[model samples]
Target: MKIIRSRSFTPSRAWGALEIANMNGITTRLHWTDQPYKWHVNDGEEVFAVLDGRVEMRYREDGIERSTVLETGDVFYASVGTEHVAHPLGAARVLVVETQGSV
Candidate 1:
């Protein structure tokens, strides 16, 4: 059993995460980041949830770049082959669920 206070979590680097669980081949992580992540397509689906602060989610759909601001409690779903990136507004904590070893 594990209980984490997302509001008090801090990362040591750009995008650092704490492993929460790994069920089957999927992984659940709590990440604290202050920098933007590179755009990449995941091998499987991904669920990104903003736990604290806000983030700018950018993605490429139909070869066009699109973006949306994700406030606290907002969730973003990215299917396989959907290229996307995340940019935090200041510091933020996010909970991410994705396949193990997915990029």
Candidate 2:
């Protein structure tokens, strides 16, 4: 067993991640980022949970762009084919769960 302190975790670079687990083709990771990610669609479902700081989650719904601010402890679920991007208000830690090798 392992104990992870999400708030204290830091990455060497923006958007860097630490792999936490891989079970039945599903992967869990902890990520640190201060920059915004590019808009893209996940090949499978994705769960993004903010552990620290804030994030502005932007997505496209029915070709209309929308966004929401996610604070610490907020979780965002992205279904397959959902176009989205994440812009952190500052340095933030996030827990992400998705299919292995998915982008």
User: What is the TM-score of each predicted model, taking all chains together?
Assistant: 0.98, 0.98
In order, candidate lDDTs are: 0.95, 0.95
Error of 1 at 56 (Å): 0.4
- Estimate, for each residue in 2-90, the C-alpha lDDT of model 1 and write its tens digit: 99988888977978899999999999999999999999999999999999999999999999999999999999999888999999999
Q: What's the TM for model 2?
A: 0.98
Name every residue pair that clashes in candidate 2.
none
Off-target runs (Cα >4 Å) in candidate 1 are none
**Runs with alpha carbons beyond 4 Å of true place in candidate 2:** none
Candidate 2 residue lDDT tens string, 1-103:
7799988888889889999999999999999999999999998999999999999999999999999999999999999899999999988899999999998
Quote the positional error of residue 9 for candidate 2 in Å: 1.2
TM-score between model 1 and native: 0.98
